[model samples]
Target: MSTRRKPQMHSSERARLDPFIVATGDASPRDQQDLMERPFFSLAKAKRVTPILYKAGYVQVEVYAVPEHGLATIWDADVLIWAASQIVEAENEGLRTSRFLRFTPYQMLSAIGRQTGSRDYKLLKGALTRLQATVIHTTIRNGENWRRHQFSWINEWEECVTRDGRVEGMEFVLPDWFYRGVIDRSLVLAIDRSYFKLTGGIERWLYRVARKHAGRQPSGWTFDIPHLHAKSGSQARVSDFALDIRRIAARQPLPGYRLDIEREGRRELLRIRPVKLSTESVGGTVGTLGTSGAGGIGTSGAAPSGLRAQDTQLTLWPETLIPGLNLESNLDSNFDVGPEDGGKPAPDGAASRSDTGRSEPVSPDDTRTREAQP
Candidate 1:
């Protein structure tokens, strides 16, 4: 006679961890635009072990990508956007938000406009892995001493699964650096929905650049091709980089910005201008600038009573803008308008001429200005 003893369940198997909970409500994700200024991630899909060291006078950023995990890409930024938007929305609603967020893969994928298929789910997991693996060492927030602070994009993450081995949701903790930026409010901005559709990496990067630098300003910002190349931390040759910029300019794929290529002497420059607002809105009371003074574009002339110029004549990385950083000397040479073109004043209200002794706009199609709403 076989006596079957009652099976005793192991304590570990008996204990069921409670799933993380999130407040039931709408999600409003926002991304800090300041991040676009630095090259914290790789633009390519290929594995990148080469560390990127970017130096412009006192401003220095060092990025190290793990060989096995590769560097985070612009696409991976969607995760941050989702996180930021959710946090912001929660804060606005007086709801609680935490670094450890509980969300199903479908929720995240759908929010970011990614397909919720199994393959896409796998890709989402890979993106999280890369974000956690890629390390960034910078002096961005650190003061004059140049004490390097190292941190990954994501601190830690875990997947919640059901008894059937089906993924129920995921929880990830954001690094302090990113979390602080998002809560600051001033560092965040509202981006266009069309931003997700940009296919090319450079085009996406360029859109961020435009949003960060140009914003809703009409005057926009100008960057020398060489300087932009160096700041981008791209492995491509300068010529190739210039070609890509030209292509992007031709397409005008960026939502709120109008791109123009002009020659300043032998130097090629990319001008990013914001699309004008509608006449009806322009007539209304003056609208506030969307970015902090430290990171906003300057205005030119006195705008209509309620309207103001979005452009400014100041340089991007001036010491005044980023205290303890001295970029004037390093960038002066690159941005210097050659003496050859100094005497010739560009046509009034027309495109400015470059030092290359050629004052004409590169693409006629870019000359027509378009209107966009923020």
Candidate 2:
């Protein structure tokens, strides 16, 4: 199959959004909190057309994938992470950004640590295909009311090809919800660039979960394995999921944090601890991990003049057992959506919840990592 993208000179992108050229790289990676905590994508490289039903207190999410593209695997999320990093990087520099982004395929692939050969370019196209085809229904940032939104990861995407058939550039529009989430400072966190090195799906998801939850809080965070299983959105049974997590813990593959599986009475729990050695993680407010202004980082800027707030300690993030999040009888079902439900996802799908859990670390010395990559 050809990876060529015919010119998209006449698309909805022209009528509205002005293209923001991606001319910079080496920006610190940032991820959305709600997406990091929830089951937003499939975990494996294998094709999955199944639906992911997840709920956590006021948060609700349901994901459906078209059979042709299958589901967007967690690996595909690297695109979003790169997009988010670009947005936040520009914002912090006082520049305007848009959901519409234009860049060479090579720029993004290299930044995200993916191989930039012909086959990798084909995989990049595959990632875009899955992202555009996977549909999501969620209530993450909905105001005070109870409303859900249905949208795909990408509204549309296209590539620039010369008459000589050489691809020169690419562009894609992110869903509004995701764009807004990236723009909101409180919703994003800087992650280690080495996070891209992780190959296993579960470990990648676990690292994000740890980055979002454990953060720089000295005490770190921990979660019950069962609650962790439910929040993970894995198709594996609880026992298998627990085993997978235990193996990851044994390897401790998460970049800036340490993982330990512990037991109390009869229940097993996974703990996340931040290494005192790495001061590279930035969260919520502007901290040590903001972009380094490398390669003319943003298009706009004026040094800010004001009183900047600092976080003395972590606060108010949801817990594994929040008081009022009603749990339905069947919250743990790993269901699939066949061809009948694939073409069009129901906008008003049934709601589900995932508990936002945390764990405390075992020891500091054993987990001292090399700090943030790039």
Candidate 3:
């Protein structure tokens, strides 16, 4: 007693699947704008979420689409699988398009626990449980009629669950459209640990911003942050990176917003000050609520050429000091490889350290004591 309609595809129509691409080293100019406007991308139009997160010197980017409405775990998985399909399809197309093609594996593992809140890794895998795709080849007959080629290909993929080491890796073929999108040169803003602490749901928010402002450069933007901590053992405070931004924005319109510091009084204001924020810090906060109140303060900078680099640290309470603070990391204890095959992960085996494990955050209690210690 099932009531599901079968999916149908036309024979003559050229199959158009979602195109996915990945570019490393420098961000492309075309793609660079996407990174700057990352805070405004829309999930409704793309039916997917493209997230970019950085650790140390590396920046990772991923894109996936959801076909359902309402927030459900099932829908999350569906989108992931859909994106994986497009990645695979795009890769196959590359073999024909170029003589020497190259691609990077999509690190879906970093995205899984991140995309799904509450560490529900199983749900992510479940959504893609029964995914399938068809590869069709076609030919032209005598210039008048187009005849279907005799070859047809179908492939099935499964979620690679690794818990101890590295997560499962997927090789993505860079399609022309997707390739062009990602190849645009951009300034890879480096991020630090503090950036992660201040932002939640940051990855998703950044995807939207980048998508919407794909082509247009901002006039100027500001980092109007309140409760920004300093590394120099002073009271936390609010300050804008306007000075730094202005330096970056030689003469264009700024592209950021203002943040109001709560908690009352000029004394409190004096206690809390703003330190100049960086792209990594800004990007980290996209999907997350900031260290302070409800909405954080953002600033708009006058348009300028090449931003100048500055070194200033915001001193917020460490994660351990914050009571009941819900911090998420790329690592988690629940991660596991598919149906244990042996004791250790195989060199060529499915169980890799990256897949089986995740990053751990500092305990709030531990942080509290350290700050107060001595």
Candidate 4:
């Protein structure tokens, strides 16, 4: 796809700002909880012009994008995930951070588990363009005097090229809204690194939903099919959406979780239970993008359950719902505004594969044995 060329440096641009260089090291992937629960990006990889308008109680979000660049897809979100991981890693070591980031295309692609081919590099540029172009308006983090707050995922981005036109480095400025959310440890969660392996759009979104909602709760989390369908901002019909969800449940694709599709009278419910992975540790990195379509079971036999319009955000599933099932409790619900642990810091947990190392499927646990680099 053709993308706009970066503008030539003008006189005013002569005063260059120093960028935060992305260092080589393990960066335990983290995601902003605000971004995890909401529909901020298009689920489909195709150029989508449809605007997303999401509302739940006081929370409201609207996303708009230009046709040329299209709304950023969830796959594009790996870049943001990478950025969040970097900020958290830097802060953990007491290093300073800024929205301005500088790194090589290969460094990013490899870290995100994408091939470092020429095409992959081109695709990276496209993702950056879409991120910079997409505009978001939301009242999610706004206080009592809530009003329209608008911003793009990125303020701007550019490539540093040699005289021979070989791109050597890249730089981008992240918006303050996103930067603040990521910098604040309480607003982040250490997601399963295997999340990058799931190749479906709905599947990927569901994993984030799982990480955000389930956390390490013994009861895990339960959401009726339709409730999830709406929150997903999926374009699929309800029937199709439920079927896709059922497929994911059957596959049990989400790492560190066991999924069971159950029924309560006419209601079909999905219960996510935290399962123990033999080597599972809280971890992450990045991955390639995938696309998905949507529809719904809106008028399906049963009425939808649990719109969850209350302010407290409590999990109220009866204890007797499931009996005698052992569940593991190792992860944290960092997504919660205030976790019980007060959001203690963790070392960089990224598990990016080395170029010379043979690639193998990441275990559900994402087990790592080597000591973390300084």
Per-candidate clash tally:
16, 12, 82, 15
Per-residue lDDT of candidate 1, residues 1-374 (tens digit): 22222212223211122112343344543456547656776665456678889854334578887787677776777777777777677556554344545456655666655655665666777788878888888655444343566888887776655555556656677766676666655566666655655665677678777776566646666788877887678888999999999998987777667999988688788999878522121111211111100001112111111002112221211223222322342232123222211223323433422211223211222233323323
TM-score of 2: 0.72
Per-model C-alpha lDDT, please? 0.56, 0.63, 0.22, 0.62
lDDT of 2 by residue, 95-154 (tens): 556677767776676676555566566667878888999999986656444368889999
- For model 3, give the 10-residue run with minimal summed lDDT: 365-374
Off by over 4 Å in 1: 1-29, 144-146, 276-374
Worst 10 residues of 4 by lDDT: 296-305
Residues 283-361 of candidate 4: C-alpha lDDT, one tens digit per residue: 3333343221211101111111111121111112122321232122101111223221122221233221211221112
Compute the lDDT for candidate 3: 0.22
Question: How many clashing pairs does model 3 include?
Answer: 82
What TM-score do all the candidates reach, one by one? 0.67, 0.72, 0.25, 0.72
lDDT of 3 by residue, 1-374 (tens): 22222112132111122112222222111122222222112212112322212211111122222233111121222232223223233333341111112121222322211332323334333323211121212221101232222211113222222354222322222222222222211211112222222222222232222222211222211111221112111121224332322222332111222222222343222111122333433432222111111112122111111112111111121223222311221112112222111122233222111111311121121111111100
Q: Lowest summed lDDT over 10 consecutive residues: which window, candidate 1?
A: 287-296
Off by over 4 Å in 2: 1-11, 277-374
Highest lDDT model number: 2
For candidate 1, the per-residue lDDT at 95 reads 46
